[model samples]
Target: MSLARKFATVGGATLGSRLLGFGRETLMAAALGTGPMADAFYAAFRFPNLFRRLFAEGAFNAAFVPLFAKEIEANGIDGAKRFSEEVLGVLFTVLLVITIAMELAMPLIVSTIIAPGFVNDPEKFDVTVKLAIVMFPYLMCMSLTAMLSGMLNSLHHYFAAAIAPVFLNLTLIAALAYGLWTGADPLMTAWYLSWGVLVAGILQMAVLYAGVRHAGMRFGLRRPRYTPNVKRLLVLAFPAAITGGITQINQLIGQMIASTKDGAIAVLQYADRVYQLPLGVVGIAVGVVLLPELSRALRGGAVKEAANLQNRSLEFVLFLTLPAAGAIWVISDEIVRVLYERGAFSPATTATVASTLAIYGLGLPAFVMIKALNPGFFAREDTKTPMRFTGISVAFNCLLAVSLFPIYGERGIATAEAASGWLTTVLLFVTLVRRGHWEWEPALFSRVLRLVSATVVMAVSLHYASGYLADWLTPQARLLTQLTALMLLIGMAMIVYFALAFAIGGADASMLRRNLKRKPRPETAQEEADTSVLPPPQM
Candidate 1:
């Protein structure tokens, strides 16, 4: 499949998942608000979510996919199956051990690491510990799910793996609905949500496992062993793990700092959900599709092909991300009020969340660029360099957050995250250029500049449009009225952006259409020969 079609498959599914996620968050807002229950539930949830990113989605895939793709290319499906079984055995064993250890340590982790603020409230703290323990096994389930997903992506079976997350959002949304119907108390409602997370993990794993099987690959776990290929995967994965770990730590730092203030954590989570819609759809979709495609291209000695893929991915990302960032920045308060200012979520909380969303929006492009660029290094088996940059970014994040938190409160932490994201992005780009792995062709640069210009136009349009809808986008307004106005405002901004982009030659609708319609060419003999010798495993 062509990259665009693959991305569309993944991006479309991700869009579904994210839309459901917004529904889940909206229900959560109505149920928990920015209160003690909300704080405890989100804090507990963050622990497993952090590990999911570290071990499942972020580190493991970066290291696993390229090697997995190479195995399939070189040794065919059977060889790939055997390698997968060995790796799965080791991964399962390790994750099981970690999950058990974390469950036992849940109390300490909650009090000291996850939410120190809750320590003063013994009941709340205890609830957090229990919720975290219930959800800890989610890490195990999802790590295994991620392995299955990596396999599917390498096999070019994107839809099932991509759609799997929808189950999670659905599970949580159902849980909330049940709680609301039962008129459950806040603590009981949180308990239901926590269990919902665990059930979702299991369902997600099942779906992806079925996907792997449908793709005509099956592997049973054996006793964990350090075979050569497994050892090499671990070596590459360790640095990527550290890189992911640092990113998580940066987030934890922000959460920890935010925790000191009542309701701050929930506010940050709300804003995070808002910005993550775009990030998940565009940035993550690009990363997921780009990694395996780049691996195949580089392995086939198609360096030019690899570079072009990176450039095109960047172009497509900015095309969508720039206008998104601008619109969010321009109408953040309205979006927050329309989506979340109901029940316990007050206008004041909406304002705070809006500011947080705008700060995050400014960093959206950099965040997506990081996603697009990291695959370049990962495909080349150069994980350590990114790890080093991540370390630097983390250190800067801590320094900035600590320095600014005392002065600016939650916004300070948000600022630090945005600043660190850009730092990591710039460092990655410079390194890629120095390594001769990426270059800014004139055409790509021009489109990016044009996209920025178009976004500016959209921003101005949105700023004016938002003023006219200000009354409807308020807590006093009827919910339906707010929704209608918010949708109309967003639709108008999108139209303005696209129209301006097309006028300025920034929009390439034809390129997207052509890419979607393009068919995969058969591999030539030279291409086969070029990929025959896999690069030596980095010990």
Candidate 2:
């Protein structure tokens, strides 16, 4: 399969999920606004996501994929299947215990991890605690889901895992809509969303289970046991967890600092949702497809091929993500207003989120590049180097956020996020170069410069459109009207950018033209090619 095809398989599935998520958040903003309910819900949401990142998705994947790939290569199908079952057995027991314990300790977790939002308001505080307890169990279900996802990914079944998140968004949307229709309290609706998360995890796992079965891999857990492989996985995962924790540490630090200012945390959270859409789509899709592929290459002693995959992954990511970053930066306000300004969401909140979104836009490509690059290290089973770099980058983020927060407030948080993204990218590049893993190719550099130049043209054009829209902002303007205008303006900006990019040899014009020269499904075929993973072991 071609690289583009692989990306499309993952990217197309993920694009659906991201769009649904946008709808879910749009409804949440309409229903809850930036008030107490929003705060409580986001807080509850973040707690599970933190663990999900640190364990289920992050450290686990970093450590598990490479070993799984190797076991399949050396020990064959049954060996890899046994390894998976053993890992799942131990993970289920441990995560179940952790979930119950965390639920029991929800109050303390909320109070310390991100307390300031609810500290002065007892109602918000209590609601967050209860909601968090309901949501905490999601970790257990999702942990199991992640294990299934990892297995499917190792088997090159990226579609199932990529498509699974859509169910989560659909569940939440349905829950939120039901709550609204019934005229229930928003807090109750938030609790329903929490339960919806657990439901989604189950559905996701079930879907991947089917995929695994189709691929002729067994999916089940035995009674818990700490086999040597399990123990090795546990040991390897600890540092990988720290490496995974690095990205979230920026958010945690920002949340802590944002707590000092009224509404800042919620503002940051809202903007983050917008930022997460693209990051989740491109970054996560690339990471998921690349990791197991890199693992297989490294295990087979194909170092040069592994590097080539990295290089191509870099090219593919830069091709797609750089423009996305540019578009978001160009129309941050319109994007915010279109997705958010309804129900209780005010114009002021839109403005706040928009500015923060712009800052986040600046870092989007770097974030995706980091995602694509990290697999190179993880596939080599060298978690320590990335861990060290992540630790340093996260520390830099903390210092920058602390130094800037007093004056910049929420924007400081945004600035810190952007700075940390670039910081990590630079560190990773240096590490790769020093180790003789990565070096500049003139063609790649030239392509990147073209992308930047095209994006600059896009940004300048969008800036004027934004200014023109500002003239229409009046107290009497309806939210729908403002949002509609914003959408139209953004659409215009994109058309102009696409046209200019093609004219100037900027974007993926040549690729698109060549693709057009092929049959109708050419893009789809290319996407599938890019997503190919390890060949399943012989029966």
The candidate maximizing TM-score is 1
Per-residue lDDT of 1-539 in model 2, one digit per residue for the tens? 65566677888999999889889988888788887777777777788878888898887789888788878888999999999989888888899889888888888887788556467778888988888887777777777778778888888788888898899999999999998899878778878888898788778878878888888997577998988999878877877877776667789878867765667777888888887877887788889888887776655545555666776678767766777788788778777877788788898998999899999999999898899888867876777788888888888899999999898778888899899989889888777777766645677677677767777877787778777787444435676777677777768766876676667665564463432121224444444446534333211
Residue 288, model 2: lDDT of 87
- Report the Cα lDDT for residue 194, model 1: 94
lDDT of 2 at 195: 85
Task: Evaluate all candidate structures by whole-model CA lDDT and list the values in order.
Answer: 0.87, 0.78
Candidate 1 lDDT over 261-363, as tens digits, reads 8988898899989998999899889989999998987787766567778878888899999999998898888888878888788888988999989998998
Candidate 1 — worst ten consecutive residues by lDDT sum?
A: 515-524
Candidate no. 1 TM-score: 0.96
Scored by lDDT, model 1 comes in at: 0.87
Query: Which ranges in model 2 have alpha carbons more than 4 Å from their true place?
Result: 466-539
Model 2: lowest-lDDT 10 consecutive positions: 512-521
**lDDT agreement of model 2 with the native:** 0.78
Query: lDDT score, residue 133, model 2?
Result: 83
**Index of the highest-lDDT prediction:** 1
